[model samples]
Target: MLNQDVLRNARSPGRGFAAAKRGFDIAVALLALPAVLGVAAVLLLLNPIANRGPLFFVQARMGRNCKRFTIVKFRTMSAGQPEGGPAPRGPDDPVEDERITPLGRMLRRARIDELPQFFNVLSGDMSVIGPRPDVWDHAIHYLDSVPGYRARHTLRPGITGLAQVRGGYAEGIRATVQKTREDLAYIDGLSPRMELYILLRTVQVVFTGKGAR
Candidate 1:
């Protein structure tokens, strides 16, 4: 029988899975905070001249069940455009090539810019592993454009996910669609082993700078 309870089935998790996942997310976030803070301290000291903008870039993102929450990241691009500032950046939001500071490029390459999301994990806004959240505006668009995208939010967003490790960050509509499919597939097969694989794969991606835009 199909679980009929669509949302519950959408998550498709086993007994205590959600609880276990949350516990792990909390543990990891707590343990990692010191390192994140240490790096942030270094970046703070250097931001004045090297980055030339806010130390952190915060934007609203779509969370599980399509709720909105603030997502935090290290500022990796120059601010203050003549027109205004940067626009709402969605998943794989493409920034101007020239706007990427040399330091930002290194952070992106090493995936260090994502460290701030550990706070989101602690706050219950996100998980350690799942689909990366979409920018609120863009997620609204995708909810209308992409089939099965709503299901992607059955679980909290993650700093890393299967699509992210496999395809990198998505840019265009075609890529977003593919990413959505992979996210859904991850949900359908949610398990301990799969999470471990994603964690392991994420390490490789970080080390190799693969799948990063």
Candidate 2:
């Protein structure tokens, strides 16, 4: 029998799963932070001219259930932008080609720009594996465009996830929409196995430097 209660409850947030995932997040972040921080230090030394003095960049991102939190990252672009910087384009457009400094390019390509987000995970603002967070502006735009976008918020935003594994920083609206569908799919089919798969695939991408940039 299809349990309506189960299906209905599934539509809501999974507090138990989230709590368990938080444990996983903390364990992984603790294990990975040393290496991540070491690399960040090296990058900061190499890219002192970029982003002025800041080695780490932090920004407000909408997290699980539309909660706002500061997400940390390695600085990748200059602090200032012209009046109208490069407009968002499709996945094929080179979004970083203009805004990214040479060092920034390497950071983005290596996915090191996102290392500091581990701190977010440790702080309970994010998860190890789930939908990625977005800025408020982009989150609002996407929720308006995508029907089930809010469903993803039932779980904490992840540093790496199904959408990210499938579409690392998609450049176009169409690609974003496609990635949105993949994120929703993940929400509907949440499980430890799936999470591990996404994490493993994400690691593969990072090592191969594929689908990143």
What lDDT is reached at residue 47 by model 2? Answer: 69
lDDT of each: 0.84, 0.73
Q: Write the per-residue lDDT of candidate 2 for residues 1-213, one digit (tens) a residue.
A: 223333344453377976777788899999989988798778767765555656776666679888788888887776664211232432234454566677777877888888888888889888888888866556666676655666668778889889888777764456666666777778777888898899789889999888876
Give the TM-scores of the predictions, in the order they appear: 0.90, 0.83
After superposition, candidate 1 runs with Cα above 4 Å error: 1-9, 81-94
Going through the candidates in order, what is the number of backbone clashes in each? Answer: 0, 4
Local lDDT at 181 for model 2: 72
Error of 1 at 90 (Å): 8.9
Locate the minimum summed-lDDT window of 10 residues in model 2.
Answer: 82-91
